[model samples]
Target chain A: MQFIEDANKQALEIMQTAQPTLVGMGIAKDVVPGMHKKLVMHAGPPITWDKMSGPLRGAVIGGLIYEGLAQTPEEAETLAASGEIEFDPCHHHNAVGPMAGVVTASMPVFIIENKTQGNFAYCTQNEGLGQVLRFGAYGPEVVEHLKWMEKTLYPILKEALEIHGPIDLKNLIAQSVQMGDEVHNRNKATTSLFIREMASSIVKTNSSREDQVKVFDFLNSNDHFALNLSMPAAKATMDPVGKVKHSTVVYTMCGNGTEFGVRVAALGDRWFTAPAEIIDGLYFPGYSMDDANPDIGDSCITETMGIGGFSMATAPAIVQF
Target chain B: MQFIEDANKQALEIMQTAQPTLVGMGIAKDVVPGMHKKLVMHAGPPITWDKMSGPLRGAVIGGLIYEGLAQTPEEAETLAASGEIEFDPCHHHNAVGPMAGVVTASMPVFIIENKTQGNFAYCTQNEGLGQVLRFGAYGPEVVEHLKWMEKTLYPILKEALEIHGPIDLKNLIAQSVQMGDEVHNRNKATTSLFIREMASSIVKTNSSREDQVKVFDFLNSNDHFALNLSMPAAKATMDPVGKVKHSTVVYTMCGNGTEFGVRVAALGDRWFTAPAEIIDGLYFPGYSMDDANPDIGDSCITETMGIGGFSMATAPAIVQF
Candidate 1:
């Protein structure tokens, strides 16, 4: 049998939903474009001093202060240098953070389990961006947004999902594709469809409009917002098959809140390092490429599977980066 | 060596969007339960004498009158007997009619293509049920509604689809499944999503609220309103495979608007007739199996490839017919 068939694949074991792998204790890192507050979580790969980028370095310093590991950016630099604080990429530990990839402990992550496969992964919600942790921008606003996502959006989504049971990603992908989504670059149909499906449940379960709006805004915020959903889905998909022994399918491409790397299933989690590719996407009328940072998380596999860029033909209007 | 694995056997060819099938015009025969005055077009599965329900028979007479084949119902009956007028089932010809699948040569239809599969089928716009032809209800109201759909709904959809291009059935199926649709039954998500996608295009192309509202009302009226879309998509998928020799996949199933029949690739185009099985679906509450027509039309095969009944698991709320 082929290691994996593009037409379809079976989830061998259903991963049950569980507690967030890095909830309730992560240090806030800062922010980045299309993402918010960064926090330092464990990593699947390690990095030496030379590989860090300005955005990633900025995130590390910011995460230290958020976690109270250091009182100032200077102090945080010392802390990381002293190696007293732990530094790990989000992917190694079954999690992925958005740009800047800073996932701190105590940050309540939405832990996703592939139901047909016992593999699991975690991700934080997307924050409406510009000067956020994932964008390598750190300050009061980033932390506050992170606080809101953790305190508000996560709870509402988690509760609604529990009541609704598993949100079948495969099923959603199929329906979304038919409705005009290729499932990677364009998710307007998928996102709107998902919100309408669960909106009733959210309204019924959450008494406050403010609370309900919090979740809604998060989902409706960014266009790449569905990227979060697609990432964990790919991670969960790769995790199970990674153990198949010599299977060439890719498992994880991640960051240590510092540098980028890729992991292959056949290589037994052996990492292949490469500088993250520069993002090519539409910018604000005044903003251009110099403002864009290199790729920062493990969401790349979404492209490998005939989606994202592969399915760009389905979305002719996707803004060119 | 599996029939399904061979691209020439089971793979559906892509469809082009410009030319829609089921193009001929037709007069309505009333088959509605609680309404009247609706006209429609149908595709595929030819129907013949002795197979029609009484309401349908009455509709045919009315159609002859509408077409001016006879001056009255009594005269129309003579026309049918003399074979002076046509009485072909819509499905027998790559088309479908609303309800009793009524059609006459004059109504306009939406031409959607399976661009990726190069196969096509057609259906008329929905006539709102209160006075529509599909329910076996016939009269001026049915005729007026048919006019409205043709004049209003069809144009807006045509323009919107033109701007957006072909609607991909595979993607739609995936999204629908995730959105909690078995596609056939629970399509709340799919229907809503499609509306939102087309809303912008409608706004841009259709300046008349009257026309816009007509399509809107029909879509919001029934959950299965998107069923027409699914039919053409299934048709396109089946066409390529149907032409593949030695392929065992069944290509067509129809009731000729009266008797149920199936056509398989390996078995050739010769239709094997079967007594139409009773259909199982929600009928405007209070209506029981006594109210349902036997499973008719080429529409049911949409379920065979994992939609409709095959996807019952996705929509648990569907009632047993």
Candidate 2:
């Protein structure tokens, strides 16, 4: 079947079926408080060594460690083959993933709820590194770090956010746009801006300066963490408009860590899925696309919300600093 | 007493010092309708005609054409020497120009307002094509296009923005963070996200289909427009915070078409200015950093908001995308 539509037809169809509404929006409500919220963090697809690329393997191994299913890469492999450990696509949870997307449940997830309509969305916290479990890097250090983030960081942030009240993601998004941030690939300004606002509150809530430092370091280390908050924000925005009857608006574009899927706003949450393609991007040293895996993760919510590749033109210096 | 501090110290000191905050960052807002927002755009330093670099010269010629100050390269030279046109630093107007940083009164500027404080800041709009205007090319097509953006594009956008209500920049920043955008060099996601929001309104307001289409084309064509928006947002946020006495918050760091300048929160709007140095970056064909001018423009608002180089970790694809 021909999947591509002519620009004119596409535009007409889009205009007819889709009212240019916001979709798949959510906020990192985890940083804010008591606003009743419901979020959905999808599961990743299952894949074995044969199906995995190098980075994918690495990410998987990292997941095993993060989940505490294995202590080492060797053990991770053995555990996977024995089926002693679970393997599932993030999509199982209605989420998307990037290269080697892998998220264990314990990982903190953002919960976004729409204020206008009572809809919501969810996504895991950012892993804070290029090569991560969500990215398919199974290693001891990776596991330990994930454990720490979940055990220490996520809870702290969740609690702090609760006390902080509802963080208005719309505000952050607007501010980010003005700060030279595209919100998908360049979130430094957003994250920093967020931290600036919440740092004092977070510090006031935490008894442990060490934890505060850790949180700050982690936040400072990962410029995309605020994105964790914003995804839910986008998710919240998208959910209200997602229920339009017979609408062509995209509701969700999730990756189950195996295939990429979409749910039309008019079609409810049922997804139209396509096998995920490997993302072509620069790799870390000693790695290449050959080492990349099928795109996985809930991050594509950015695109559903009208960001990501759709806006690449805004950032021509993308390939370089 | 010398008010100027060291670069790094000034960064900290501006935020630390007590001073009045500047408002309305970005040129688009400050520009009077029908009056091209004019700021003198300058470069790192002066260069001899014989030493003129390709991209730098090309940018100047583009600037000339954009300003309609010259009919041709030969004519542009005459105009430049005739003293019929003004050559001043963008900083003088409380604005910035990036790259070659050449600003003519005819060039469009972003106007940003601090909602709470009512401070204003301005910066010229992005030229779209690489190695143009800011890179120091003076020519006719450039001038005509600038005129078009001023006469046609800017007014429509201003009205649409007004109708849309004030864009909540903070909200975009937060959402963009989750989308993997850092609000700096990689603003693709942020850029597209904003366009998606504003497109419908812009279409509704445009009188003729052709006019609407032209504006759409311009918005879609210019990737850097979102960057313009982001810069102003950062300026707005940082401006208020910088007003805090001895807060040590860096409010502004920008190049005035010819020089790099910084304004500490403590220092208020006092510019600690210096000659802009050439940047080290990948350039287009037949151009290198050697062919480039000193980095100019209020684009540094990204840095002020903590993206650009600050959050390089988020986009590991830097220098590799």
Candidate 3:
């Protein structure tokens, strides 16, 4: 008991003192350890192709098309079932993603480093709401947008970050929290703050004005843009706790569409999993409980770090939504 | 008395309904009526060169050098004293500027239009704090910076405004008031909000990335950048009240470094003046009351519109400064 208490205290200290800085960005294959061309990472615990849910399957198919591995949904499905493509959890590769979080090798990711622990975490950019790859819409428009993000958004932000140096995530988050952002469901303030902070450097990059404008417009319109950064920041913060031997603190909590899973500090890579439950929350127009997918995404990492739903009172505006 | 009360009601209604929109920008000589190559507009009521305060005189010299009419301070002083040059108040040409408020022929000025009144008001861009033209430091660096603003900053913002259409100042000010900005001495929130609003369009301009970045960097670093806009908006808002018959409202208040002046509605263009009072507020480091300049600039236009210091309670954070 004494050993467990001490380990928990150590884990708590690590979490409390973690300094997550958004260091830079890179293509997944180039930066994420063990990422490969044929490898695909999804949110939550690992699942075989046959067990994957609709949204997850849709995202994977979209990712394949976006990656140029397959031209059509039918072809993507066949290749996925052929076992030639390897599927793994984003968590296994020091990454986290949101709903149907399918990340392929070519996707751009934010590289967040936790200075206190000298560890890093990664996450892909958020493709704002409605008919997006995250929600499993693999349309041509979605693929084109993703291409634009890779071609235009990625390099501009990368260069801007170079100019801006590493931005302290802890400080940004603290400021946003005070400004009425839960940093998960309500990131409007966080996104605005980020835009304000990056506008100067972003304009300085070599990107053409047309491209720069596109980036600014995209970020301005997407209130959820900072969610990706916040997720990786949480992931980086919690990763050190995983190494605290004898600590029983829950370090990761995420759900694939088919199942919910969590990992404890002392459990050492073992996941405690159960059947995922359907969300009993508000739905968009023309949708109801019957159309709802089961609980999903590594977004719960925000709640795991005591924000998001854990601190809903900080963002009263989210209640209306 | 009844006629005056009715006129006052009309003036109040006009002020309440005034919609000042930032329409565009142009050179003062080209857009401001009565502006000429040899005419220099200063703040407050008109004064001869001999009576001008030290800061006002310094700004006049800097304006001459900036306009290329003189090569040195001595040449500038000779030109000012030679009767060949003209000195007038910015208020005479529907303009307002801060501090010494010197407007030269080629200086860029924001064109703020009161849509309801179909009249326009103009103000030069704020040069930010210390050792600048507004505070009357006319070093080579100041002249060079002023040139950069005319050549680089003006076109980018002008094109961006063309793309952005008209920005409604009333709505922007309302939003900023809620965010702890007095829109005068504290324009941090207003500037940030303006940057967030304009960034998308600014990036879309035809300017080179280097130039665009310079513009963004300039705006981002200058927390008082929006002060210029607010002053012109206030001027535009109060200008309509000046046309009301028999109204006793005090609509215009400004100061040259040498004297403070006020204009009353229904009294036409008559200016009542007194020797300017020295500011008894906080001083910057290495300065004291003994070194203080008299109360100066067109900044008090914000106070005239019932914000600025008039509504200081709305911006409690300004007290710390």
Interface C-alpha root-mean-square deviation, candidates in order:
10.0, 19.1, 2.4
Model 3 regions more than 4 Å off: A1-16, A44-54, A75-88, A171-182, A185-210, A242-295, A303-321, B1-13, B44-52, B78-87, B171-181, B189-209, B245-250, B258-283, B286-290, B306-321
Task: Evaluate residue A84 in candidate 3 and report its C-alpha lDDT on the 0 to 100 scale.
Answer: 97
Using DockQ as the measure, the top candidate is 3
Lowest summed-lDDT stretch of 10 residues in model 2 chain B?
Answer: B17-26
Error of 1 at B137 (Å): 10
Model 2: residues >4 Å from true position, as ranges? A1-321, B1-39, B43-65, B82-84, B238-250, B256-276, B285-292, B316-321
> In candidate 3, what are the lDDT values of residues B1-321, reduced to their tens digit?
899999999999999999999999998988999999999999888889999999999999999999999999999999999988899999889999888999999999999999999999999987866579988889999999999999999988998999999999888887666555788887866777788889988888887777877887788778789999999999999998988879999999999988899999999899999999999888878998899989889989999998999766756355222
Model 3, residue A153: distance off in Å is 2.5
> Which candidate, 1 or 2, would have the higher TM-score against the true structure?
1
Model 2: DockQ score: 0.02
What is the Cα-based lDDT of residue A321 in candidate 1?
Answer: 19
Best by TM-score: 3
Once fitted onto the true fold, the runs of candidate 1 whose alpha carbons sit more than 4 angstroms away are A1-39, A42-45, A48-50, A61-78, A254-260, A286-291, A304-306, A319-321, B1-190, B193-321
